[model samples]
Target chain A: MRPVVPYVTAALLFGLGVYGVLRRRNAVLVLMAVELMLNAVNLILVTADTTARAVLPHSGQVFALFVIVLAAAEIGVGLAIVLQLYRLRSTVAVDDVALTEPPVSAQPVGRDVEAGR
Target chain B: MTGADLLLLALGAVAVGAGVLVVSTKHLVRAGLYLVVCLGALAGDYLVLGAELVAWVQVLIYVGAVVVLLLFAVMLTRAPIGASDDLDRPGWPAALIGGGAGLGLSVLLVDAYRWSTVTMPGAGTAERLGEQIFRSWVLPFEVLSVLLLSALVGAVVLSRPDIGQPAPQRGDTAGDTSTPQTVGADGVRR
Candidate 1:
């Protein structure tokens, strides 16, 4: 098979992912874009496993699996952060996730929303 | 063209088309669903390339778990089910950069390996891949396990707001365990 098809596909996928990340304001959407980029890289790795002659066979596939694992972990933590952001700020827009101090009106809430127990 | 070439081309088109929709769709839930389609089509591409293990892993992890988590997050954040005009920013710069990077990479790769046929490797089943991972790539695998563990801990901590907060004011939550009066209040809260 001609490998260029998958290669170009991966490139365009990564590019689309980049556009999503840059243009989207929703944090979840940005993470989804990042997933697109990661999947593109995984495609490249698996395709390279078929095309290249490495010292260790199937290394590309192995690495692709590892990348999948890494991405799972990333999504888990990323959504957690987004949830916490929503709890504090009431919005999941990426524009408002500043590292500065909390807003003035946010100081008086007494309850921990998640620590219900 | 060979059957494999045609299959790759077809699956690649599906994957990219779905990917565009994933990022560009107006409906938030539809974007997540479109991500499922895009990733599943990429899994198909992997199958066409003979990477069976990677394809299944992609389906299980990316399509199954990650998309579900994203949808849950969307709902949790109370994002509108219909459409939100504020989801996107100005796009021309993003388009310029994304298109430039993609085109540059595609041109480089195509020029490097234009019409050359790919030499198919050995069948990358779970058995052979496991051996390669355990025998040669053991250290990285172990480190990845540790990383997963840390991510678990970090996510738990980040999700809970009461984990390590100092008592800024005694009146903030008089429901301290030391006081029995607020016990009824805390009980009512729970």
Candidate 2:
């Protein structure tokens, strides 16, 4: 039971994150899932850090700190982009705003056209 | 199980539950709020793991800054605050893919390191962490800072309002008291 608690928590968090990314349609939720995944990784790092405090040094915690900062910046910019999409589409559902190809227009010409063209 | 183990189980349950709610709930704002809960639980887990500095930073950066920014964006975008019944896409494939990947990774990880505790040094403190970040990781840290600065500049450039006319504030009782309308697709009020 030494590291069991942290291990279970990390696994659960990772699983939930997967579920979020899979099932959530809102782009915001997707971003949140990504954050959850990152935090799960952090938990593992901290657990390992605790176990190896005497040998491997503080690199684990330091790496986790860097990750936190990176996650902040990523969320800030990501939400801004999502906000932009919402303003244009009036909805945040990820599938609603996809544009595969631009519409094109051209003159129509056909052999079965009316009269002589 | 010890007290620490019980605490870990509790935090894990909360985090997983909140994460499920975050995705399954129809209200987007609630989802963002749930993320706060999930991250908080994660911070608690970090504390239990003895990474106190990392734990606090998790609270500060994720719960304090990231989620707040997300909420602000949700508010500014005027995303529906209530349950939305819109079914966007066929999500089963993505779910299957993600779930499969997670399962595979979990199995691999468990198989590779099953309850094998290998404790290294400086796991709980920040002294060596500071040294590492300043020494070996200095270049990457500086690069990350520059990247953040550029992102900030880009956000301003892309989303700044370009409204042609100025309007009275909502608090001005002499005029219409309606809140300012967000202007464009880019979060600019124009």
Candidate 3:
């Protein structure tokens, strides 16, 4: 009964995090929201493992530790890329990035060369 | 309602509300702050579940490390601190529809699983968890360490300044790529 308390709370937290990740536009904030979601899942896993007899495998906590490490590494790489994007372009808006190079028409430089001649 | 139920409800409300605010707020920094509140409530929930080790890890990893990285990234990227003019997208209608469907599914799942009750074996402690981690999950744990190593290397590579570009002369320009480049109309090297 007491364990159910955490499970319900964790579920609600996970729901909210899902909403955030889906709704937010900022990439960094999206990552933060993702972290919240992962944390919520970790809470549920820990609670479930602790409360259940057969499911009470210690792997849940170990898996959670792995999640934390992975999250840290992800943030590091993600932020670096975002910073790079910000440097290359003036903004970090997801829509602003061009996955492929924008096509450009070659402008005639003959007139300027002729004038120089 | 029982004491446990009431407590859970209160904590759940706080966690949910804060989590919503983390996404809803336009200010990126403020959103990170709201995330902290949400995570802190989650740690509290972990405590209520009798998972002291997990609760501390929640505080250490999510509250401490992850959120700090988020704040640093926001600052480093120089994302606008004030409210963004562009908040919601035109696709919000589709998002609402999808969200509603997912919510309905989750509700159905919860109702279906309501009959299952969890029972603990003996007392679950950190020592027991450690024994299992080292004994059974040792291979996966080592693999995770390898993954971390790769990530560390990847981060260093990604953060490295572009090697193709010539280093900026000290008198003419700042050497750091973090600074914005100002191009002259004549296009002479800065």
Predicted model with the maximum TM-score: 1
The alpha-carbon lDDT assigned to residue B73 of candidate 2 equals 72
Instruction: Show model 1 residue runs off by greater than 4 Å.
Output: A103-107, A110-117, B167-190
Q: Which stretches of candidate 2 lie over 4 Å from their true place?
A: A51-56, A101-117, B117-123, B161-190
A46-65 per-residue lDDT for model 1 (tens digits): 98988899999999999999
Q: For every model shown, what is its TM-score relative to the native structure?
A: 0.92, 0.77, 0.77
**CAPRI-style class, candidate 2:** acceptable
Clashing pairs for model 3 are: none
Q: TM-score of candidate 1's chain B against its reference?
A: 0.90
Model 2, span B123-177: residue lDDT tens: 4556756777888889989988998898787676545333221244212422332
Task: Go through the candidates in order and give the clash count of each.
Answer: 0, 14, 0
Pick the winner on DockQ between candidates 1 and 2.
1
Interface RMSD of each: 1.2, 6.3, 5.2
Write the candidate numbers in order of decreasing lDDT.
Answer: 1, 2, 3
For B38-130, candidate 3 gives per-residue lDDT tens digits of: 888877766665566767877888788888988988898776778886754454753575356446545654665563545544434678767
**Alpha-carbon deviation at B187 in model 2, angstroms:** 24
What's the DockQ for every one of the candidates?
0.80, 0.27, 0.32
